[model samples]
Target chain A: MATVVAVIASTHHPFYYRASTATGEDRPPFADEWVRKILTFRETLTRADPDVLVMVGSDHFHQLWLDNMPQFLIGKAPFYDANWYNEEREFGLPRMLLRGQEDLSGHLLREGLDAGFDLAFSNELRIDHSITCPIITLRPEADLPIVPIYTNIFAPPLPQPKRFVQLGRTIRELVESWPSDLRVAIVGTGHLSLELGGPRQFGPHGPDPEFDRRAVEWIANGDLDGCLAEVTLDSLHAPGNATHGFMDFMLMMGVAGAGARADHVDTLDLFHTMEAYFTWYPNGAPTA
Target chain B: MSRYLLNKFLYTVDRDAELVERYRDDPRGTVAWWEAERANAVLNCHTGEASTWLRFTDAEREALANHDHVALFSLGAHPFLTLTLFIAMFERDHAEPLGFQKQYAVRLAHFDLPYPDIAT
Candidate 1:
């Protein structure tokens, strides 16, 4: 059986690639500190030494569109092309290619369906920065194969928050039961009180810092009861219009298990939004 | 009003570099042409299989033609699509970093919560 080595969650700020790579006068004052934190966060995954990663992220109208939006889709292709032209035009994110773990993708799709997910599968998926940002931050080598799971956080009439958590828990169940000797890490990215294209956007910090403060505590302590109690489709709007992405974090919390405190936690209060990183070792901390 | 079509306009235009430039240089022309030629063209499929439905309302068309981000928000157009495409079009005009985005926010500051449901 595969070992569930790590469970990780983060914010996939598209700006980080440009910000961290900038130099000289072009570099933002906060860039160095941001890069330093990412290096340390990167070490958490390095320590886990997982052979495969199950990446969870949401598509931002890139490949998926309103014409036929899938609430939850899994990429089962042998390889995934990452980033899009606009991402390059807007954020300077380089094009990337990632190998996929087909067997696990197949296992998850089969088991996920039997578990009642109605999971959608894509044979050819061009992943966006939601999955790539973590690869840049945590696994720069991009050496390991991945199974990219996309949740519909951007589109409305989305699956409820609890369903995300249930999916996360189910992922944990299936991963542990998969017939493989490789160690696997589950990594997902989401937002924290972000307000894009709205009145509160591009603020000094994330639009609702108070909500971000509570959200950090909820995830750090694995407080799903507290998180789900307050976070509904309606209530999420108040934090910021785009805050629904936080459901991915709830799904990760479900992956981490209830009442399980994160072993590694860090955050940077950057403009536009907060960047958060977390890693949990399910069995125990890896020996460095 | 087909917020979906409004998004389709933004999505299609943003992805194409030529279209982004064309839309920025000629918003009215771009929107007019898009509605007629591309609005019902189901993506990732042969153009011959395009749908007969999916035109934007006059108000939706005008809001887009004018590049009115504020009106788009009111019409429940997806904020990310509006912001991304608008920034691609107008952000360069600003001399300062994030200047256009900050101003974009101010334009829509009058909007209150229960923000025109974006369900579609």
Candidate 2:
């Protein structure tokens, strides 16, 4: 059986690549601190030393559209072309190509369907920053093969928060059940009190810092019951219109298992949103 | 209440560099042309198989034509789409980083929670 190496979740801020790479007068003052925090966060994953990654993220209206949208979709291909033209125009993210683990993709889709997710499969997917931002931050080498799972947090009438948790639990179960000896890490990214394209956007801090405060504690402590008790489809809008992305965090918490505290947790407060990072080792923390 | 068509306009135009420039330079003209030529065209389907009933409401059309992002938000168009396309069109005009974004927020400051329903 496959070993679940690490269960991780964090905010996928699109600006990190540009901010960290900027030099001279163009660089933002927050860039250095942000990079410092991210490097430490990066080490948490480095110690796990997983051979494959199951990447969980939502497409920001890049590929999936309302004409025919899926609540949960997984990419099953040999390769994925990532980043869109608008992302380049706005966030200065470089284009990237990632190798796919087709064997794992097939296993997840088959097992995920039997587990009742009605999972959508994309043979050809052009992933956006939700998946790429973490790759840029966590795995700059981008060497390990990945299975990209995209959820519909961006579009309306989304799946409920609890459903995300359920899916995450199922993913953890299936990964462990896989008939392989390879070590796999589950990595997902979400948001903390975000308000995109709204009245509260571009603020000095996340639209609702109090919500962010409570949210970090919930994830670090793995308080799934506390989070689900407070978070609902309608209730998410109060923090920020886009705070629904936090469901991905709930999904990660589910992967980490209920009441299982994180091995590492860190946060950086950015202008529009608060960046968060968390990692859990199911078996035990790597000694190295 | 064709919020889907409103989003379609933003999505299709935002992805295409040519359309972004055209929409920025000539909003009214670009909106009119898009309605006639591209509104019914399914993104991944054949042009001949285009849906005939995907046209935007008069208010939606006006919002896009005038580049009125605040109106778009109130009309149930996805705020992310409205914001991204608008940023592409106008962010270059600002001198400081995030200047255009902050200004964008101020434009819609009148809105409160339970903002418009964005369900397609």
Candidate 3:
């Protein structure tokens, strides 16, 4: 059976990459501190030596649109290309040949389907910033294989938060059943509060640190039910429609298993958005 | 108002490169072909060729053309598509002509939105 080694959840806003080169006036004071914390998180992943990294993030109309939005989609390819944009280039993001684990991806698709989830499967999906920003910041070396799971967080009628939690449980079951002696790491990347293009798009609205604190506290204590109870569409959407990134966070919590507890937790509020980093071991211990 | 027309317009343009090229080639024709009444009005307002039959206020027309993101948002344009359209129309070449963050910062300022020192 595959051994679940580590689970990490962190924020992946594009600005995390852009802040370094920005002028002193444009750079936030917390930017350097955030980078240091991110590097530390990366070192933890490297120490875990996960063979396959399952990345859960949402698209931003870059790959999927309303015409063909799927509730959940998994990438099934041996190699995937990161969608290159001028903004990413300006940030000096290097061209990366993202590696994929086809065998594990196929198994996940089969398991997900049999378990009553109609997950969309794609072999040629291009990834957006949600996945890239995390990888670039946390794993720039690109040493391990990754499987991209695209959840429909941006589109309306999103799958219930509980469903994502259940999906994570299902993923855990599949990993446990795998015959290979593999180390797996799941990375959930997104933001805490972000409102884009709405009435508050140009206002003084920003990240709600109190909300983020409560949500993270629940996750750290293994209160999946509590996390879901508080972090609802109404609560997340209260900040901004773009705050749907919480869906990915819920998935990571679910994959950590119901009883799994956080051994380490770190967070930063970048004024407009909040970032949270967590490391979990299966038995609620510092080491699995 | 049902944002169906606006959603459809943005969805199609973002997903279909051919249609985006078509839109660039003939904005009015593309709008007419889409046959979405409100999308047509929105695009037409931007092109300075308002439909004779469509009735839109001068403020609405200016909002559409100037890529006033908040106005588009109020009209129920998807936030992702709103940013996509802004990039496609104004920042296509990635030239930070209006300054890197200013493009979005200025628009956010218009609506008294918080301007974060970050890129989209």
Candidate 4:
């Protein structure tokens, strides 16, 4: 049996690592307090080491584009290496990244298909920095073996919010069906309230603060459905204010059976970025 | 969206193997061909079925030959994005529009991280 130990989602902004001093001095144009926000998330995820992590994120032009497209995909790469570190720039990856977990990944795919999710299959894959940033932040040692599931929210003709919720519910069963004695953690990486490149690019006057505040309040109040009903592309500013990556986190909540009932974790408003964290503890017979 | 059988695409591959082969050798042309065909398929699809088969016309077939893996990945059309379209032939069914059967093998793109294996 499988038990979902924790469900987490955060912003997948590029600036998380690029602007941090730990990576380099090429800090983003935000105030200094942003560093503390990133550091806090780094600590929380490291503390909770789940056996198998089901990561739900988006794909940019790094993979497919308009000419050809895949709406839903599940990657089962045996040797999925984190390809975020640029050696030329002296970039060191996070702490808990574990390489090579083909067996678990394959099982997830098979089970997901059996559950009627119609997941796409893949052999080789590279991890974009948007996905990589959260991994490094959560597990600094880079020891967790991850099973990545991508949603097409960023891509056009996307699955509706209702359909995405259904997909998440299906994942809950797939995770529980895993015959391995593994503790599973699901992470959704995106944003709460910040737009991509807004007019308030420099100081504290941006979507980052306001969005961050609302998200934190909602999560703390355990209002998943309330938040979902209100959030939208126009509401969040399309790919600009909110990068649709937040959909990944919302889906995770559905899978956890925390649909419309997820408990809030923490929210940090960094300069030009609104980093929000969420976790849902499912009620029912614990799989562990 | 319109729905056709996966066989439609396979038939093109089998019936016009030589043309596709030539297009594969010419990368730029292959991409142009793929885009035109895909646009037509998506634009013309009216069926509500979960999946459909797409057979390329003469002009569309030329476009498919120009498609590259990167271009394919960019579309992000999923759950049904199969890279390897194998042809299944039956005796009498071979001559009909819905004659052939098709199955797609999945392909995944590398995540954008800074790993050595991902580099050029």
Q: lDDT for every model?
A: 0.93, 0.94, 0.69, 0.52
Ranking by lDDT: 2, 1, 3, 4
How big a share of the true inter-chain contacts is recovered in candidate 1?
0.96
**lDDT of each residue in A52-99, candidate 1, tens digit only:** 999999999999988789999999999999999999999999999999
lDDT of 2 at A148: 98
Tell me the TM-score of chain B in each candidate.
0.96, 0.96, 0.53, 0.29
Best by DockQ: 1
| Of candidates 3 and 1, the better by DockQ | 1
Please provide TM-scores, in order, for all candidate models, with all chains considered together. Answer: 0.99, 0.99, 0.79, 0.60
Q: Kindly report the docking quality category of candidate 4.
A: incorrect
What's the lDDT for residue B50 in model 4? 28
- For each candidate, the DockQ is 0.93, 0.92, 0.19, 0.02
For candidate 2, lDDT tens digit of each residue in A29-145?
999999999999999899999999999999998989998899999999999999999999999999999999999999999999999999999999999999999999999999999
Worst lDDT run of 10 residues, candidate 1 chain A, spans: A13-22
- Displacement of residue A238 (Cα, Å) in model 3 is 1.2
User: Interface RMSD of candidate 4?
Assistant: 20.5
Candidate 3, superposed: residue stretches over 4 Å from native:
A20-29, A86-94, A199-205, A283-288, B1-4, B11-68, B87-120
Q: Which regions of candidate 2 fall more than 4 Å away from where they truly are?
A: none
Provide the clash count, candidate 4: 62
